[model samples]
Target: MRERRTIIDAGWILLLLIWSVTILFPLIWVFYESLRTNQEFFQDVWKLPSELKWSNYRKAWEAYGIGRAMLNTVYYVGASLAIGTFLTAINAYVLTRLEFRGRKLVWGLIMLSLFLPGINALVPQYILMRDLHLTNSLTGLVILDSLSESAFYLMMLAGFIQSLPKELEESASIDGASIFQTFFRIIMPLSTAGIVTVAIFKFLGLYNSFLGPFIYLSDPKKYTIGVAMYQANMIMQYKTDWVTLFAGLVITMVPLVLMYIFLQRSIMEGATMGAVKG
Candidate 1:
């Protein structure tokens, strides 16, 4: 049994090593490619860059309007992430804590929506947004996403809220704390790990969201990072500036990488933890 366990552990470690290389190689390759001039890239696609042409990043930023698109992404992603996470937390709190009629039914509906592919609502959502004159406006995108319901995250946060001790609520109420006060001051604070986990997930989703932004936002100034990257791809067909495109992608990816690196410990630790105390 000991020998078998050792073999299994070794195999797992080997697999993980391979997986890490598989993921890291492309990012390293792209960083090198971004530093190469178009001439050097064509000369040898895999060769080390003789000189790092940092100007590629500048050109990509100015020519592709990635700077503007990045700012737009900041607004679009920030507003949506904040509103969505708060609303999700509130919904989770209510669903788990407050007793009401048809609660199970509402939860069931949410579960049903979770199973439903979001693509099914694509056409109708576009029509609604277009009719409301929301298309091509970043503010419109913010409003639309902020109000949109996501049942998946609802369930994620609900589990954490539900795991919390009822005694906390009881203790707050005994001190004459109102429901809102108990929730905001006690529940919200206790559910910090879970809330942070949810916020991180929401931020990642909002940052990478492509189709909705592409379909609704028509103006160049309003383009998110995803849409701007797509536009860069379109430009590549006409003018093959691969190095600059790679630089833009590298720029887009660095922040996300840093964010995940900083919060990775939280994600791992938060998943199994709750506010419960003995």
Candidate 2:
């Protein structure tokens, strides 16, 4: 039995190492390729550059407009994450904590939305944006992203909120705290783990969103990083500047990698807390 358990543990460790390599190898290759000149990259796809071409990053930023696109992405992502997280938290709180007529029905509808294909809503959403004269604008994109509720965040937050003790709320009420006060001061603070988790997820979604920005914003100046990446790829088709394209890709990946590196622990904890009943 001891030998069998040892063998199983070794197998799991080996599998994990393979998984890690698969994920890391592409990122490593991309970064290395970004430092090479187009001639070197095309001549030997697998060989390291004899001399690093740092100018590739500068060209990507200046010529390809990655800098401007990055700033635009920050605005869109920031606005959407701030508004979306607040609304999702409040919605989850109300659904889990408060009692009212048709509450269960609302919950059921939200659950039903989870199973529905999001692509089905694209036409209606586009029409609505067009009617509002919001298409081809950053504000329009923010409105669209902020308004769409994530059932996953709602459910996670609701689960976390459900696990909280009711006595804290009751105590606040006895102390003359209004529902709003209790939510903002007491509940919100206690639910930080869940809120941060949801916010991170929202940030990633908005940061990486390509389709929405691609369809909604007609102006090149308003393009987000995702769209910018696509545009860079298109330019490469004609120019064959693969090194600059790789640099642009690396720049786009940096924020996401940094965010995950810093917040991975919190994300894991929040997920665990939400899953387990208190």
Highest lDDT: give the candidate number: 2
- Model 1 regions more than 4 Å off: 274-278
Clashing pairs in 2: none
Q: For candidate 1, what is the lDDT?
A: 0.89
lDDT of 1 by residue, 105-148 (tens): 99889888977898999899899998999899988888888888
Worst-scoring 10-residue span by lDDT in model 2: 269-278
Residue 235 in model 1: lDDT: 87
- Residue pairs with backbone atoms closer than 3 Å in model 1 (clashes): none
In the range 1-278, model 2's lDDT, one tens digit per residue, is: 99999999999999999999999999999999999988988899899789998888998999879889989998999999999899999999999999999999999999999999999999999999999999999998999999899898899899999989999999999999999999999999999998998898889889989999999999999999999899888887679889889998998899999999999999999888877853
Pick the TM-score winner: 2
